[model samples]
Target: MIRAQLELRIPNMTAYETITAAKKSAIPDDAAMLRAAVELTKDISAARAAIYWPDCFLSAALGYGALAGAVLLRETWLAVVCALVAALALYRALLFIHELTHIHRNALPGFRFAWNVAVGIPMLTPSFMYENVHTLHHARTRYGTAEDPEYLPLALMKPWSLPVFVAVAALAPVALLIRSAVLVPLGAVIPPLRRVVWERFSALSINPGFRRRPPEGEFGRMVFWQELGASTWAITLIASTQFIGWRPLLIALAVFSLTAVLNQLRTLVAHLWENDGEAMTVTAQYLDSVNVPPPGWLAPLWAPVGLRYHALHHLLPSLPYHALGEAHRRLSAHLGAGSTYAGAHYGGMMPLLAKIARSTMGRR
Candidate 1:
């Protein structure tokens, strides 16, 4: 029978049953809880999400302005200060890409275009790369499996791979520059090259095994223009370096590299990363993900723009980024001490990193 075949295909029915029972007991009605949270936050305006645009623009301006001031002043101490500030600001601004994915197109008209022009193109990480790709990671059947483009089992990898994973992000700026400046143009002219580029270079994914399918319809047109914009920006930056001098370019690279590194660090603790390509249950995904709650002063610095409630986001993917905090507060108050949600809270980054390190070493 088809039911028997499905049971055979599922790796561990015992484990699945255990997880299902746990989830049911912990949150008696997950759907109702989510619906209530949605209703509770319904009166909150979607326009609050649009307000992120000005903040992101201002942050980017401050970052670049400080870097320029540092270059003009020609002081090592000032340059160091400027670089740190730039890194923080740029990292925060770049995170709007995540927000852009969730915000309805009609709710924030022209905001996506503004963001692409200001942050996405200049950084060579256009929004198109992430738009369609991230949604897959949130898919119920895809998450924590090989099909999830955004996930990898870091805790199950070799102990040495952890440091390498985080350190490699420092080189992302160079890789992104090459991707935009060299790959995009070449791919445009050659059909075969375009297919290769689409599969390999198009997505903002971390999984090595994931390959992107070619964009189609309106998505294809959007991808084309976004790529063109990034290519033009990359070419301009390269050409301008010759006349404007390389110092500013070097500062830009440094800022980008630092931002990438900071993001990688945040990502490292985003989850326990122990799924090992298994098709996880919803509770398993929530348990594997992390949430760093209050009293952690540095949580916002690392997990900015509502990422601090990452596990909760997975549970309620439709909730806008601006409403996550309030949702978490409501969910916590409603769910109380016995809820499975408590298991997702890591308290702070240091503890999370330590737990991951222990898990990595223990697997060794």
Candidate 2:
């Protein structure tokens, strides 16, 4: 009966499929199921200013405080512990950039500027980098293709590619440093370099072929201030090596490097990565995304800020992170374990990582 019902209903393609030729997945269509996701989440759609403010601020505060502790503490064991705490907290704070993209412009006024001041510029990953770009990943037609900046056909790649994917992320802190300090400063004087930098280096993306359009209007103005802020901070950081010495700066980079790796690991399992550069149905995109809900306590630590429910977020992009847990509960109960909605649920990070790695090996 359930199988029969799923076949009768289906919807449009995902952000990966929003642009070009989007074909329905071979899996049975679940139009009613998709509708249920929207209907169930209606009550929780509003973003709460209270939650948004504290979560981002507190996390960034704890991260920076711990980072300072790590740099100052002389004992090896204690400093190592502080460094780990700093990395995890900062990683949580950094992931808020994802939220900034989907959130309404006026939902949390001054949030963009405050966040850039607190975490974004310091990390060299301001909201402007992701604000306009990430929406394409959720576009009705662009997902899973060369155009989807966040989508990569990783499951179909060679086994070696998986390790390389992670290794590249470890260098993110250093790469971002150069981008802010050197490239951006030079781009200010040279129009062509500015265009190339905007198109190529400005986004937080996974697909190499995904080029960003130049920011214009209000967004372009936002980019200018953010670029200036990041450059100034980056120069300050570089100058600090002369006054305070390289030890402190290097230590800070080390903490951020670990934070970057943790984020990459979380991102790896956020989806099934089985799209193969083709358009996917909305349900296919949801299924391609993985949900690590309950009984997985470790998920919150790593995939913090409702990111543990990534697949669900794809269903309701506007839903605030705080409400996702209750939303997941309601949807799971409404749909049941055997339903198409439950197909995206997974246990933990390692298993999901193993699954993706195995798929790369042709075992899937």
Candidate 3:
């Protein structure tokens, strides 16, 4: 989904370790590794704390606003307006999933289950799986190519292929759902087909390299419990909501779907535009993925959902969404002008899509 270029000059190990150790303490060596680990943990914790409140408020407001709009609004035009407002709310909820899962529980009390039910299950994804995948993304984000499961493989793009490339790409999510719900349950009995299916998934955003083996051991049990517990709650909510009438339920589901689409479009705008040729092969964080001149009035609304300063988020995913603007400012100051880490919103979809198509097609 990303077409950004990333270049990381690997540091010399011994010297890098020494420097990292130096930053933590005056210790010449030995306990340097522990200190570095502790320092990283501390930094991540601090970042998590910075954005916790706004994230919670964003979630509550989105949920309540959707409910309120659904209850108060009638008429066809009002339903359209309700859908727009609900879509924005749901987008924030999805982003909240992305944010809360990254947050360490010790950094924020009660974030564990709150993130699971409120964010994960509503999005129809398992939080435990996301925790593993997301954390590893931070670990090896810059390690692109087919090796890094978090990125789409180079050969995966068939833009000029038959059945039309764009249509195939757009239909990918439906294909994924079918595979997950159907083929995945068949297990080892379908080894040959499974292998082919696995290859297809391997080409997508999440690399199968770091995929969690569900039936393995202790961690497997924990993942199961988390997934099961959250899913039970989500199912209960959905089933109980029948009493609230199908109208509201359908409206909410529609809102969630539209919002997810909007979020995806926003993601493409921020990250998928081709830069230099080499840049297309890199991780999203390095591709100069940024916003393009978003409206002033929209900033407040977008800021809460982690859209206003997306470039910074790409660079530093561990930073809380709320702290993104500040982080962008500071990083921008450090890097000076022409830094891709800072960005504003660009207007409209057609122009950007045209630019991306031309770039991808190798046209001037």
Candidate 4:
């Protein structure tokens, strides 16, 4: 019964059809082409792949510093300017957490800890929430299925659902604060609430029906400590509001909200979201994903931290953020314009969004 209901909700080419069609049009030997691309870029150093820690920290510092300065200034024009700068910086810094997930462990030791302390705690989006969840989205058999926690059929849903999807993110800072400050410690003491938090609040997932298994071993320990750190920071921030005056707190909230909104927009165009709740072939998944290539001067501003190459990232998940641009260049040159690789390149976000909008409206 549940399977039937889910099938009813998915409104596009069935998974089998999509996969077959994609394979027919794909490069004759995608694996070989990808291997060749990998060989071409193999010399890219892992150390260089590591997030530039100074830049990450400095960006966050400048963002928060601007926010603080804005609060002090109390001038509307200056506050708006500072708030926009802060939002862009925070968005870029927070995106490094995605890089944290893909980084080779030995390639960047202690970077995760530094990220959690500086950007994660303040933004209320600790790395633990994304760690286990994002990997599932990359899993070949799970990419477009209900099991893919990071996916939701936003492009297939009702037209009104798009704005609501992005608008909800504006409340994330407050929601995260409540989850960290109130739910974390309370759940630690109550077994039932603990289960609830673990299954629901602990993951940065979009699929409401998705449930998480309890964490165990080293990853479990990391989750526990990261949550504890976030809880501590949330409590401190909440308690300090009385003494520090609420203006700074308000400004921080504005920046955080704006950052979340920007992230929502980036995510909106990440994929075509046309899969019908079934497993997809690598080629199909690549086709479903998107890439906004060159001269989209503002692409980096909106989809920073290597997300502008999202489709290419799907092709080579292990490719470091810093190396994606180079990888894309090599692949484009080798594969030529006629390949399936060219199909994934959208040129710009506006075109992608319009395509998704048409998809959504046409279905109704």
Candidate 5:
């Protein structure tokens, strides 16, 4: 029955076809049952692939490239240039990583961890920690409050101040990086910072799976290891640079930072819309996310990561990123007018920014 309920929302080739497909495929000679199983399996597989590899590899490679480029380059400006390129790589990478967390692991053991960590660790963002919070975001009654990490309360915003609001959304990734690298490190050291640390940590532990799921446990351990590894990498870079002189390190850092900033833009594009302040729930995944149907030139970045067809991704998180486009087309063909968005991109920013700014001026 639970499986049957989900089929209604799952993306398929077409609504009529989805229904027909379900009917034709239903289990137990009883078409409904067979269809339900097929749908369920597809859903699970999609989710798994989305979170794990071949799906996630492109993004991870991008992040690694940026950080590595920063470390290896000899010229300062050129190093920064490479770092920017690396950042561009990661910008695309995070998309896959974001999708990967939505997957249910049991579906395809093949693509699971390969994509998750491959894409996740390089971003210096732990897959495990992301999974915990992200899963909660899918829960009943989650958005608009402290629980919604991505939440931005309309109540807090000044009415009509579109520019400020837009600015907030645009610069959010910067805020995230600063908070992660600076605030988190400081929070760890300062006794007074315990509250913030606990709040973030509590979010991880508060979830039911945090205590019950072994995958969750593994994630926790991985977070510790990744953090240690990232720190060690930073330190090693520093030491090596001192020995060889700072040129290489400086170049690498520039490339890495550039990539990080580009990632911020793409990340913001994923969710910066204005909506009623409803709780972000599992069922609401579609609402909180956006799809990026990339142009041919951008496909190299988005196709591998599975972000180009993100709406389908929200519907099926475990499917490998590579499979997302095909799945999305199939589902989109099935759903037709039922879909809400085709998703937007950062390139649409100039007008969006201007509109928001105008909205704010009128309010003031």
Candidate 6:
């Protein structure tokens, strides 16, 4: 009913190129479009520190500022307003974690540290949560398979799973607190628990069956420091309630919970989520992912940090967040609307979300 009302409101919206479970076999990749995507975007692939630093820092700064106002204002309507602002700003800041997984570590020196200090550890989502995990989603053989940490066949699951998938994220702040403040700290004392936490709870992933291998090499060393920072922060946050009282902590948790929910909603439509755990070709994976591109508006707000061009991101995983818009424009104009590259471009977030929701209900 909400979707029907939304569709009626957008009477002039572009008709979407919907892909459902039944439509999988018919949607093949255009090899020429693939080559064009790689070739055309080469010049823009390098991450610009100029764009990365300010965006992440400002978003984090604004988020925390608003969160403070919310807590200070108490239960008033203005506090509610501030809380919402905090959620949105922090959601934008938090999504930089996705960019962290893709961009070269050396490109933005101190960015990883700054982001962790400002946004990541405080939010209990250090860059390490995504660093090793998200790359597998782009692996040629792992994309859309059980091995893909981020892949989930939501369209193939029962209709109930859709709401469950999204609703569960509302508890993410609480879950992260427990994971960091309790499980991780305990895991440090118990070797078996540490391995379990590493295998099961370490990643920011959607696939229930996906278990991450132990972190190795310099990556492992990086993980240790990040984990220590996150755990320490989490412990401090929990312990603060005794002195500062529950009001501030509860309000902050509520704000973070809202942020998590927004992200989960974005994740819901990030892809069609219809691969059925099979290995897919690169183009097939790209087609499965969704892009909520421009002229519709509001995508950048919901799918911030260049995530609005998610399908294109899968095609050229190294293209930095700031460059995605230009890359998308070049490819869209070059390939035209009828090409496979255009297959993933949708009108807007609601329609794309409605499309995915409908898919789970056994409709096209």
- Cα lDDT of all candidates, in order? 0.78, 0.85, 0.47, 0.79, 0.47, 0.84
lDDT of 4: 0.79
TM-score on alpha carbons, each prediction: 0.89, 0.93, 0.62, 0.90, 0.60, 0.92
Candidate 6 TM-score over all chains jointly: 0.92
By TM-score, the better pick of 4 and 6 is 6
* Top-scoring candidate (TM-score): 2
Candidate 6, residues 28-58: lDDT per residue as tens digits? 4556877998899889889988888888889
For model 4, how does the per-residue alpha-carbon lDDT over 1-364 read when each residue is reduced to its tens digit? Answer: 4334323322222222233333222312345455765687787636462347876888889888877767777789998898898899888889988877777877777888988899887788889888878989999779888899988877668888787888999998888989999998899899999999889878878788899999999999988888888899999988988899777777788788999989998998998887778776676687788888897899999999889999888887877888889888888888776565676778778887887887789666
Predicted structure 6: lDDT:
0.84
Name the better of 2 and 6 by TM-score: 2
Tens-digit lDDT track for model 2 on 233-254? 9999998898989999999999
Error of 6 at 212 (Å): 1.3
Ranking by TM-score: 2, 6, 4, 1, 3, 5
lDDT of 1 at 48: 66
Residue 98's lDDT in candidate 6: 89
Which is the winner by lDDT between candidate 3 and candidate 6? 6
Assess the local accuracy of residue 72 in candidate 3 as a C-alpha lDDT between 0 and 100.
63
In model 3, which regions exceed 4 Å deviation?
Answer: 1-45, 48-51, 64-73, 153-219, 233-249, 273-285, 291-304, 339-352
lDDT measured at residue 130 in model 5 versus the true structure, 0 to 100: 61
Could you list the CA RMSD of all candidates, in the order they appear? 5.3, 4.4, 9.8, 5.8, 9.1, 6.0
Q: Which candidate is the best by lDDT?
A: 2
TM-score attained by model 3: 0.62
Candidate 5 ranges beyond 4 A from true positions = 1-81, 93-96, 106-123, 153-219, 280-288, 294-304, 337-364
What is the per-residue lDDT of model 5 for residues 5-114, given as tens digits with 9 covering 90 to 100?
43544433222113332222121122332233236446435344334444346555656766676677677787666666666666566554455465455655745355
